[model samples]
Target: MNKVIEVQKLSISSSQGCIVEELSLSLEWGKPVTILGETGSGKSLLAQAIMGALPRGLEAKGEIRLLGKTVECKADIEELWGREVAMLPQEPWLSLDPIMPASKQISLVKRLVSLLNKPKSESIAIDSLARFGLEGSEGKVPSQLSGGMAQRLAYLCATSAGGRVLIADEPTKGLDSSRKQQLIQLLKEHSNKGALLTITHDVEVAKALGGEILVMKQGKVLETGCCESVLNAPKSEYARSLISARNLDHQRGDLLPNHKVLLELKGVEKSRGGKTLFSNVDLSLREGEVLGLVGDSGAGKSSLADVVLGLVQSDKGSVVHHQVLTRPKMLKLYQDPPASFCQSITLAKNLEDLCKLHQLDRKDIPRLMSELSLNSELLNRKPDSISGGELQRFAILRVLLMKPKVLVADEPTSRLDPIVAGSTIQLLLEQTSRINCAVVFISHDLELVKQVSHKVVKISDYVANHSSELSSPLVTV
Candidate 1:
C-alpha cells in the first residue's frame, strides 16, 4: 500500500495547554482510518494541523508529509488543502453559507475544481447531490434545509472535488440512523477508490468503516490497531472504556429509580405556516429520568424543546407540571454558548446577574463556577475572551444555579469534542440526579440518546412513543 499521509512527532500547543503532542501516524492510499477520542482530545486539531488550518495562537512542531511531500507551514502548504486533502467540518451548518443556495455552494466547489485544472461538469454537481440524498435541495438555502440535509450536502460538496485523502470530522453527529448508514456506505465507496481518515467518537461508525483505529487522549495517541482488535480487546484502559461506552446492550433495563412525574405534555399540538409540526404528542418526564427527542433535522425535535422552554407557543394543547394545570418550569441551555451569554458583560457579572434573578446568593456563584472547571479570572473577563467550551461550561453553571424543575437542552453537546461531550453529558446527568429534575435532552447523536436517556422518543409519524410504550423498537437504518 502506498502511504498517502504521514505525521512524525507532531505537537500542537495553545495558551490553554498542549492539544496534540508527539503524535505520529501513517495512512495508506485506498484505506480508511478512524481517530477516536473524547472532546478536547485534539482529534479535530490534528486534522486541522494536517490541512494547514490550525486556529490562531496555536503553534505546531514536527513534520506533516502529504503524499511523501513535506508541508512545513501554512505558507509552504498552499493549494494543498481541498485539492490533495479535503475536510468535512464537524458542524455542517458552519461549513455552509446560510444566505447562498445549496446548489450554488456545490457550483462553487465545482468552480474551485476547475481552477485546479480538474473541472467537473455542471451535471456532476447535481449528481453529487443525488448521491448524498440531497437531490431536490438545489434551490434551498442552508437555513431552509434540515440538519441532516445540510450534513449530506456538505459531505457531497467536500467529496465532489476529488482528493487523495478525505478527513471527515464527526460527519454523523446530527444524522438519523438511515442517513448514517448512507454516509457509511459513501465513505466505504470513497475508501475503496482513495484514502480516507475519519475523526469520530462513535465506535459503531468506526467499526462499520472497518479501518485502522487510533485512540487519542489529551493530544496523544494511546492505542492503534485493527478495528476489531482495538474495539474487542483494547490494550489501553481508555480504549477499553471508549469501546464499552458504545455498547448499548449494557444500558438495557436501566431505568431511573425515582419515577415521579415532573412534567407532562398532554395532546400537545404545534404548527408552523399552517402545517402541523407535531400533534397529540404525549410525553411525561419523571424525576431522575431523561427523555430523549430523536429525529432527523427539522423533525420538530428542537421545536418541542422550545415549547417546553416557553420560548415558543403551541397552537393547541396544555403542558402540565406535577399533575397541575400549570406552565412548564423549563430552563434551556442553547447549543451556542456565546449566544447564551452577554458579550459585553464580564463572566462574573453575568453569573452574578443570573444568581440575582434566581434569588441565589452571591457567594454560591464562585463555588458553582469552580465546579464547572471555570477559572475565577474568567468571571472578570468578557465572553469574547473565552473559548466555546468555556462559555458552554459557564452557561451550564448558570442553569444549574437556577435549579429549574425541568431542563430542556437543545443539542448541547453538538459543538463540543467527544471527550467534552461525554463529560458534559455526565455532568448534566449528575446534576439532574442530585436535583431530582426531569430532563428533556434534544440531540442528533443517537448513541448519546441511547446512553443518557432512560426513555427514547423519536419524532417520526408525528407521534412521540416511549421506549417502554412500544411493542417493538423501530430501527430505522
Candidate 2:
C-alpha cells in the first residue's frame, strides 16, 4: 500500500521551547487516523507541522514525507498543502473570509479546483448546504450565520478541494448531533477517496471514523493503535486517564429547601427580520440549578441567553429578577474570552480593575487563582500570553469574583479540548454550587449538557441524540 504521509521523529519548537517533541507516525492512503489529547497537548501543533503552517516563531526538525517525497522546507510544504493535502482548521471562522457570502466563497473554491465553472459552483454549494441542514443559508455572510453553520460551510470549502489527504482539526465543534453525523459521513466519504488525519478530543468522532488512534500529551506520543483496542484498553496511563476523564455522573442532592427562583423570563418573544426566533417562551433558573439550554444552531439559543444577560432585548417580554439587577449580580461567560478582554492589560490588573469597579475584596484573587489551577505567575502576564484554556479559566474566575446570583454561560467550552473543558466545567460547577448560584449552561455538546445539567430545555423541535456509550465511569486523575 502506498503511504500518503510519513513522519519520523518530528520535533516542533519555538523560542520559549518545544511544543511537539519527536512525534512519529504514518498515514496510509486508504486509512484515517485520529489524534486525541488534552488542550495544549500538541495535537493541533502536529497537524500544523504536517501542513507546514506552524505559527510565526515556530520551527520543526526531523522528517516529514508526503507521497514519499521529503518535505524539509516551508516552500515544499506550501507547494503541497492545498493541492495534495488540505486542512479544516479548529476555528473555522478564522479560516473563512468574513466579507464573502457562503455560496460565493464555496463557488470560488470550486472554480479554483477547475472542477466546475462559476455557474455550476452554486449548485454544488447549495447541495452541500442542504446536506448540513443549511439549505437557505448560501447567501448569508459568515457573521450572519451561527457558529455551527459557519463551521459546516468551512468543512464544505476545505473538502471541496479534493485533496489526496485531509487534515481536519476539530471539524465537528459547535455542531448539533444531526449536523455532526452529516459531517462524520462527509469525512468518511473523503477518507474512502484518500487519507485522513483528524485531530479531535471527541471520542465518538474517533470511533465513528473507525481508524487507528494516536494519543499525544505535552508534545509526546503516549499511545497509538487501532481505535477500539486502544480507546477501550489504553495501555498508557495518560491515555487511560484521558479516555476516562470524559465520563461524568450528574446526580446531585436536591435543591436546598429554601432555594428560590433567581431569574425568570416571562412570555418572551424575540424576532429579527420579520421572523420570530422564539415566541411566548417562559423559563426560570432557581438557586443552585444547572439549566441546560439545548437547541440547533441558529435556533435562538444564544439570543435567549442574550435576553437574560441584558445584551439583547426581546421584542415582547419581561425579565424579572428575584432581587435588584446590578453589574455584580449577574455575569455572562462568552465562548471566546480573549476577544472580550482588554488584551493590553496584565491578568492581575484586569482582575484588580474589575474588583475596583465592583468594590470586591482583592484578597481572594490569589486563593481563587490557586483553586482554579491557575499559576500565580500568569497573573503578571498579559491576556495574549496565555493559552485559551487558561484564559477561559481566568474568565470564569473573573466572573465568579462578583459572586453573581445568576450565571449565563454561552457555549463556554466549545473551543476547548475535552479534558481541559471537562475539568473547567467541573470547576465551574463546584464553584457555582458552593455559592448556590443558578447557572444557564448553553451548549451544543449534548453529552456535556446532559452530564452537568439539573434540567434541560429544548427550544427547537428536535434534540439530536448523541451516543451515550462514548463515556464510561470516570477515574479521577
Candidate 3:
C-alpha cells in the first residue's frame, strides 16, 4: 500500500483561538481510517484541511501531501481536489444542488472525471443508481428523496469519478441500521481502490470499518490503534469513558402505582395529499413514565407527535388529555435546535424574548441552566457558535422553565455522539422525573430506547392497521 494522504504537525486556527492542535495522520491505499470524537472536536476541521476546503478566516500550518504531491497554497491543493481527492459532505441533501435532479448531478460528476457526453453520462447514472438499490430515482431532486437515498447518491458522486483519496463526514448520520450496513459495505468497496477516511460520532460505524481508529477530543487525538484492540481495550481513560457512556444496561424501575394518564391518543387517523400517513393509532402516556416510540424515518412518528402536541389535527379519531394544555404547559423539543432559534440573535436575546412571550419568570432561567451543566456565559453566544449537544441542552433548559406536564422529544440525540447523547438523555430523564412529567420519546436507536423507556411501542405496527403500512418490521426492546 502507498500513502495517499499524509499530514505532519497539522494545526488549524481561527480568530478565537487554535481549533486543532498539532496533529499528524497518514492514510494509505487499500486502508480505511476513522476519527471518532464528540461534536466540536475538530474532526471535520481536519477533513476540510485535507481537502483544502477550510472555512474562511481559518488558516492551517503544517505539511500535507496527497499522492507524493506537495502544494504551497490552499488553492493549489484544491486544484487537484476533484481529480485526485473527493469529499462526501456532512449533510448530503443540503450539499446537493436543490434545483438539479439526481440524474443531472451524477452525470456532472461523470463528466468531470471522463468527458462523457450527456446521453452516455445519463446511462451511467441510471446504472449506478440501480447498483445502490435506488433504481428509477434519477429524475427526483434531493428534496424529493429521503435522507438514506440522498446519502447513497452522495456516495455515488464521490466514488464514481476517479478519485484516489475519499473523505466521508458523518456519512451515515440519519440512516437506519440496514442502510448503515449498506453504507459500510460501500465504503469497504471504495477502500479497496484507494484510501478512505471517515469522520463520525458513531461507534458502530468505526467498528464495522475494521481499520485504524483515532479517538479525538477537543482537537487532540487521545488514542490510536487498530479497531478491535482500541475499542475493546482502550488505552486512555477518556477513550474508556466514551465506551462506558454508550452502555445501555441501565435498569428501569417499576411504573408508578396508580399512575395518572397525562396524554392519550385513540384511533388517530391522519392523511395528506390524498395519501394516508397513518391510521387507527392508539397511545397512552402516564405521568412520570417514559414511552418510547420506535420506527424508521418518515414512518409517521413525527406526525403522531404533531397530533399529540396539537400542532396538527387528526383527520379522524381523537386526542384526549386529562390535564389542561397550554402553550407553556405542553412543549416540544425539536430535532434541530438551530432551526428552533433565531440564528441572527444571541442566545441571551432568544431567551429573553421567549420568556417575555411565554410570561415566564426571568429568574428561573439561570437555575435550570445550572442544573443542565450549561455555562451561563454561553447564553451570551449565538446558537451557531455552540455545539449541537450544547444547543440541545439549551433547548432543554428553555422547556424546563415551563414546568410542563408532558414533554414530546423527537430524535433528540440522533445527531449526537454516543457519550454526549447518553448524558443528554439521562439529564432529561432526571429533570423530568423530578417534575413527574410524562415523556413521549421518539428515536431510531432501539438500544437507547430499551434502556430509557418504561414501555416501548412500535409505530410500524400501529400504522399497519390502515390501508397502507410501513414496509419494515416492528422493532421493540
Candidate 4:
C-alpha cells in the first residue's frame, strides 16, 4: 500500500477551548478515509490543519507527513496545494467566484494546473460538468446557478489540478439524493486513482464510500473500522444513533387543525438569468400547517420560498398574505444557520437586541430555551463558538420569541448530522405547533420532508422546461 498522508497527536484549540483533540490517522493511496461526525466535532478543523489552512485564531499542534516530506508551516504546504493535495470546503457554493462563469472557472483551473491548451481545457471542463449533471450551465456565474449547481462547480475546480489527495469537507451539503449519489461515486472513482478523505455528517455517504471510517464527536474519535462493520454493527452509542436516524420511518401526521390560510401564491411564475425556473405554480399555506417542498437541485425550491415570503416578486403571479402577518411575523430559517446570526457578537446580545426592538419580555427566553433543550451558557458564546445544531436551535428560539405567523424554513437541517438534525427538526415541529404557526419547509431529503410535512409539493411539476446555451438557471436559494 502507498501511504500518502500520516498524522500523529493532532490537536486544534481555540480561545474558547479545545476543538480537536489528539487525533491520529493514516491515509494511503487508492483508499478513502471518511470522517463522520456532528457539527462541532472538529472534523473541519482536522482537515484545515492537514491543509495548513486553519483560521488565524485557531492553534494546531501535530505532525503531518506528506509524500515522505515534513511540512512545517502554511508556506511549507502552500506549494503542495493542487499538486499534492486539494480540498472541497464546506458550503462550497459560497466559495465559488461570483463573477466568473461556471465553465470558465473549471477551465481556468485545468489550464493553470494541468497546463492544458484552451480547447482541451474547455472540453474537459464541459465533460466534468456533464459528469456531475451540471451540463449546459457553462456560461452562468455562481449566483446565477442553484445551490447544488454551484457546489458541483466548486468540486470540479477543487479536483481539476490532479491533486493526489482530496479533502472534502461536507461536500454534499446542499445536494439532493441523485446529486449526492453521483458525487460520492465521483469521489470513489477519484480515490481509485489517488486517495480521498471526506468529512461529512451524512450517514448514507459514509456507508456508500465504504473504506475506513472514523466516528468523531466533540473532538474525539469514538469508533473506527471498515465502513460495513462500523456502520452495520456500530459499537458507539453516538454512531448507532447517527445510523438509526437515517433508517427510521415515521411521519408528522395531520398536524393541521383546519386553520385559516396564512399565505397564498396564485399562478406563480419566476425566471432568473433569462431562464424560467418554475411557472404557473399555485400553493396555499395555512395556519398551523406544514407544507413540504421537494424537488431536484436547481428546480426553484428556494425561489418559491422567497415568493411566498415576499422576498422575491413573481413575474406572473400574486402572493397574498393574511392581514395579520407582517414582515416581523414572517420568518425564514436559513439553510446555513450561522448566516442568520451576527457573527461578531455573542448570541445573547443578538437575541437581546431582537427582544429590545420588539419590546419583548425577557422571561420568554428561558421558557423557549428549556423547550428547545438549549443551555443558558450558550448565550454567552459567539456565533462561531457554538455548534451548527445549537445555532439553529437558537435561530428557532429567536423566531419563537417573535411569535411569527408564518415560518419558511429553507433546507434548515441539511448541514446537520442525522441525530442532531432529527432533534432540531422535532424541536421545530413542536415549537411551531405550540405557536400555531404555519410552515413552508423546503428540503432535499425526501424522507425528512415526508416525516415532518403535512403535505409535500413537487416544484418541478410547475417548472417550464427550456433549453439554452448554458442557460445558467438561477434557481433561487
Candidate 5:
C-alpha cells in the first residue's frame, strides 16, 4: 500500500479546552508532509495523539491507520514503535539517556528495535554518527555534548529502528544553518523509503522539504496546499506574516551602545576535555544593550555565556560585574526550558517560590503573562504538561519577573513561531530598555542577532584551531 499513515477526525482535548480539534490527514510513502503553526497551536498535540503518548489529563479521539490497517482511537501504539514509526522530539536531549554514550545509544536502538546483532549494530552506529559529523563523539554522554551534537545523537537513535514512518517535531531547533540543511536532506531521504511528518516553526525548512503543507492556528487548519502555494501566495494574513519574519533586519535595534559597562570579561580562557574552546576573550556589555553571540553548532557560545553569568569558572582570566550587579541580579535563560524548571512542580508553585525568595509581588505574573501571550491556566500545569513554546514563554516570564541587571538569554525565541517570535523580541527589547538591563543574547541565527542586538560577535572569528571535536571563538564587533 502507498499510504503509511492516516488519521480521521482526530481531536485532542484537555480540562481547559480542545487543543487539537477534528484534524485529519494522510501520509504516503515517498512523500513528506509538514505542519506549520504558531506557538501553542496544537501541532505537538497531534503528534502525541498519533503516537498514543499524549500526557495525562488529555483525551484523544480519532481513528489511526498504519499501513492501511485501521487501529482503535487512543490505542496503545507500543507495537508500532521503531519498526513501524519513530519520533524525533523538540527537546531531543531529553529523549536520550543521560548516562549512555552517544554511539551506544544508537546501537541499543538498533539492537532492540531493528533486532540487529550486537557487532553489526555497533558497526552501523559508528558509521552513522560519522556521516552525521559526530565521528569523535562516540564516547560522549548526552550532558557532555553541546546541544546541537546531542540533538544529532538523538536523531540517530530515533531512525536506527528502520521505522517506515517518522514524526519529527522541531527536529532542527538547535542546529546551525549547515547542520539544519543536512538533517533536512536526511529527512527527505527517509521519505524516499517511508513517510515523513515534520512539525516545525522554521519557514525555510518547510519550503525546502517541498511537500504538502498545513498551517494551523488556534487548533484549526487555516491553510493547506503545496508548500509553494501556502508559503509563496498565502491566502491567510498570518501565513504572510510568518514568511516575512524571516527577512527581519537590523533596523529594530540600537546602532551604538554608549551606556556604562555593566559587565566585562578579561583575558578569559576555557577548555573542555583537553581541547581549547576559546581563549583571550575580552568583551564589555553596557546597560540596556543587547550583546549578540553567534557561532556554529558546538561552539563555546554557551560556555562563554555561563562564564558571564558566573555559572561556570574560566580556566584563566576573570568575569566581573559592576558593583550594583549582584548574584541574584544576574540571571540566565537556559537553552532548554524544561531543564530550567522543576518537572514535578506546577508552574504556579515554581513562581510562588521565586516570588517568596525575592519578596516580589505575585500580582506581577498575570500582567507579564499577558505581555508574553501566555495563558493563565498554564500556571496550574506542571512543566511536562505544557507545550514547548508555551513553556518557553513562561520561562521568559520568569526571567522578566526577576528584572535582572544582566540577562543571559540563550536562544530565547528559538522555539517560538514567527508571529509570536517577532512580538516577543519586541517585548524583550522594550522591557529590558525600560529596566536598563544588559543582555547577552546567544543564538545560532546570526541574522536574528543582527536584527535585535546593539553589538554582535561571531565565535568562529576567534577560534585558534578548527575541528569538529573543538570549536569556539570570542571577539567584539
Candidate 6:
C-alpha cells in the first residue's frame, strides 16, 4: 500500500474547546480509511481540517501531506481543495446552492474535472449522476429533492470532481438500505481508484469497505487497526463499548422485553390533492418495544410521523393511545438538527424558550443540560456554532424537559456517529423507561430499526402491496 495522505501531530481547537488533538494517521492510495467516534467527538472538525475549511475562530496545528507534498496553511489552500481533495458534508443541503438546479451544481465541479481529464463536461456530469442513482434528476433543485436524494447528489459531485482524496462525513446518514448498498458499492468503486477517508459511526459500512479503522474519543485517537481486528476484538474499552452497543441494537429481540400494545393506529389514511400517500394503514406499538419504520424517500414514513404527532390531519382513521391521548402535546424531534432549532438562538436560550413555552421554570435548564452532557457554557452560543451531535443532544434535552407522555422522534440520530447514535438511543430508551412513555422512532436505517424496535414496519412496500386492505396490520417483524 502506498500512502496518499499523512497527518502528523494534528490538533484542532475552537473557542469552546479542543476538537481534535495530536491526531496522526495515514491513508493509502486505492484503500479506504474510516474515522469512528461518537457525536461531539470532532469527526467533522477532522474532515474540515484536512480540507483546510475549519470554521472561523478555530485554530489548527499539524502537518498534512498529500502525495508526499506538504500542504501550506494559507488562504490559497481553498484553491487546492476540490482539486486535490473533495468533501461530502453531513448535510447535503448545506453544500448545495438552493437557487441552482442539481445539474448546474454538478457542472460547477467541471473545472476540477477538467484539471484531471478533458472529458466532455455534460457527459461527465450525466454519467456521475447516473452512477449515484440520480439519473434524470438533473432538472430538480436541492429543495425539491428529498434528504436521501440530496445526499446522493452530493456524493456524485464530490466523487466526480476527480480529487485524489475523497472525504465523506456520514455519507449514508439518511439513505435507506437499498440506496445504502448502492452508495457503499459506489464508495468501494471509488476506493479501488483513489484513496477514501470515510467518517462514520456505521460499523457495518466500515466492515463492508474493509480497510484501516481509527476510533477517536474526547479529541484523541483511542484505537487504530485493521477493520476486522478493531471491530471484532477491540482493544480499548470505548471501542469495545461501541461494538457492544451496535450488537445490542441489531439483536433487539434479545435485549427488549415484549409487552402488550400501548398505542394502536387504525385505518390510518392520509392524502394530499386527492393523491393518496398512505391509506388504511394499521399499526400497533407495545410498551418497551421499539418499532422500526423502513421505506424509500417520500414513502409516507414522515407523513405517518406527522399524523402521530397531530401535526398533519389524516383524511380518515384514528390514532388510539392505550393510556391517554395528548394530541399535539406529544414531544417530537426532527431528523435534521437545524430544522428543529433556531440557527440564531443559543442552545441554552432555545432550551429555555422551550421550557417557557411549556410553562416550565427557567431553573430547570441547568439540570437538563447536565443530564444530556452538554456544556453549560454552550447555552449562550448560537445553534450554528455548535457541532451536529451537540445540537442533537440539545434537541433531546428540549424534548425531555417537556416530559411528554409520548416521544415521536423522526430519525433523531441520523447525523450522529455510531457511538453517539448508540448513546443517544440508549439515553432515550432509558428516559422512556423512567417516564414510562411510548416512543415512535422513525428512521430509514434498517439496522437501526431492527436494533431499537420490537416490531419492524416496511411502509413503502406495505402500502403498495395492500392498497385495498390498508386497514389490516401488515407483516410484523
Which numbered prediction scores highest in lDDT against the true structure?
5
Scored against the true structure, residue 100 in model 5 reaches a CA lDDT of 91
User: Model 6, which residues run further than 4 Å from truth?
Assistant: 1-3, 15-17, 67-69, 72-74, 99-101, 111-131, 135-144, 247-277, 283-291, 310-328, 417-420, 433-438, 445-455, 467-477
Better of 3 and 6 by TM-score: 3
Q: Would you estimate the TM-scores of all the predictions?
A: 0.77, 0.85, 0.82, 0.88, 0.93, 0.81
Count clashing residue pairs per candidate: 7, 0, 0, 0, 0, 6
Best by TM-score: 5
Position 282, candidate 2: lDDT:
70
Better model by lDDT: candidate 3 vs candidate 5: 5
Q: How much lDDT does each candidate structure score?
A: 0.73, 0.78, 0.77, 0.80, 0.83, 0.74
RMSD values for the candidates in order, in angstroms, are 5.3, 5.3, 4.2, 5.1, 3.3, 4.7
Better of 1 and 2 by TM-score: 2
Error of 2 at 171 (Å): 1.5
In model 6, which range of ten residues has the least summed lDDT? 467-476
As for candidate 3, its clashing pairs are: none
Give the per-residue lDDT digits (tens) of candidate 1, residues 229-260: 99889999888877776333323223455557
Clashes of 6: 6
Which is superior by lDDT, 1 or 5?
5
lDDT of 2 at 198: 94
List ranges where model 3 is wrong by over 4 Å.
67-74, 80-83, 92-164, 249-259, 271-277, 312-315, 327-329, 361-381, 466-477
The candidate with the higher TM-score, 3 or 4, is: 4
